[model samples]
Target: MSTRQYGTFVVIGSGSGIGNHVAYTFAVKGFSHIIPLARNDWTYNRVCFFNAARIVLGGLLESVETIEENFETTNIALYIVAQWAIPRLRALSASSAAAKSSLLVTNSLLYANPIPQLFSLSLVKAAQCSLVMSLAKTFNSSGIHIALVTVGGAVAPEKLESKKYC
Candidate 1:
């Protein structure tokens, strides 16, 4: 496969599972800026190339200088790190032409179907889908591309309260 050249993109929900894998993928190569934003403290390195790479961790910006100091705010390139935050981040980043951002998300297949066990998640997914459609329609002029990926059962969670879910 061929790789495209671009600057840093932020990874949300990046901790121990698929999110961490994607963050490490970006950190390995392609981009120089890899911002690993995770609510959890888990970090997984899938490749050796990221062994010595610099990964920045920040939850949110409290001050302008805070982001400047940590992520070099001069370059405003970014990407949403979470599945649900993907559209919001895409819109925020694409609100300006300088942001130069793109969104790549991994949504679950159940997002389209209804599951009794994951009923709450289904509602969230429905809302997320509507937001994605709205954002795509509103932000196409800002040079931001939205890539939707609905996938499931590929990478299971490593740490679970009960093994039955696995």
Candidate 2:
């Protein structure tokens, strides 16, 4: 059966892992417009500047996440990605007639349930939660629903795959 009755969903960070889970969930539910924010070893490092930033900063920041290991692609370039991608997705959804259109984020319960090892993830997830809430408040009246789901823990297999441009 479908998780959503009907709608359009665009998932980011769906190369592999949690982000992929969210994308597959929506696809099974029969939602159109699935977009995967993919990355790999080569592009993930060379294209992604987070590590470079860390190096430039001399590793002083302990919270700097590795591109391959981190699901928070929204973190490395939040301002640019969110600004351009999110707006475009919103616009596309606005043009569609799908019911219950929304954005879903895969966060960890590790943050929610409470544990020091996962505190950083929790913080990132908390920020995602806040963003969802803010988006909900801003768009609910306009007919968009936003949900921040905590996946409880990391799971095997991803819902989507990353496409590399050769």
Candidate 3:
């Protein structure tokens, strides 16, 4: 699809890992305006595709500071951006027949299958999942599509050389 069809694509936490790959994928798909913002830089002038997929590695033995950090990056940040984007997305849906405004959050299965070593990550992810579900229930009928993309394992940049044919 053309950029005019997709509008602007904004990717939060695009510094590395899954978020970075998402931004690159959208660019390759001709999204045109792909706004890649750091974890702290959620502010954006334009409203469009919002991908909130920030992650932090934290362990159970870690201090409370680490747990709080995990929550801030994964759950709180997504909530803050959703509050700002939802209305704008709804507006776009109302204005254009073709426009399908969506808020996509990257999630993980660790929320359900918790690991002791990554307990903080698991807790925050569970909260994030709940938030996304609530958002979807409240906004899906209104044309603002809220979705959670759950990754089952650790996320890393794909190596092109590792490609194997089945």
Among the numbered candidates, top lDDT falls to 3
For model 1, state the Cα shift of residue 54 in Å. Answer: 28
Clashing residue pairs in candidate 3 (N, C-alpha, C atoms within 3 angstroms): none
In model 1, the runs with Cα more than 4 Å from the true position are 1-33, 36-100, 157-166
lDDT of 3 by residue, 1-166 (tens): 2223355788877655777677666665567677777643333222344344435555678788888877888888888888888988888777656666788887889879988777888888888889989999999998777888777887554442243222
**lDDT string, candidate 1, 1-166, tens digits:** 1146668878877766776566555544467676766553232221111111112333332344443442321112222233344555455554554454555433456457756554444444455555555656776565555545565543333432122211
Error of 1 at 58 (Å): 32
Q: How far is each candidate from the true structure, as Cα RMSD in Å?
A: 16.4, 13.5, 10.4
Task: Give the backbone clash total of model 3.
Answer: 0
- TM per candidate comes to 0.38, 0.45, 0.65
Q: Stretches of candidate 3 above 4 Å error?
A: 1-58, 160-166
For candidate 3, the per-residue lDDT at 88 reads: 89
Local distance difference test values of all predictions, in order: 0.46, 0.48, 0.71
Candidate 2: where is the Cα deviation over 4 Å? Answer: 1-80, 93-100, 158-166
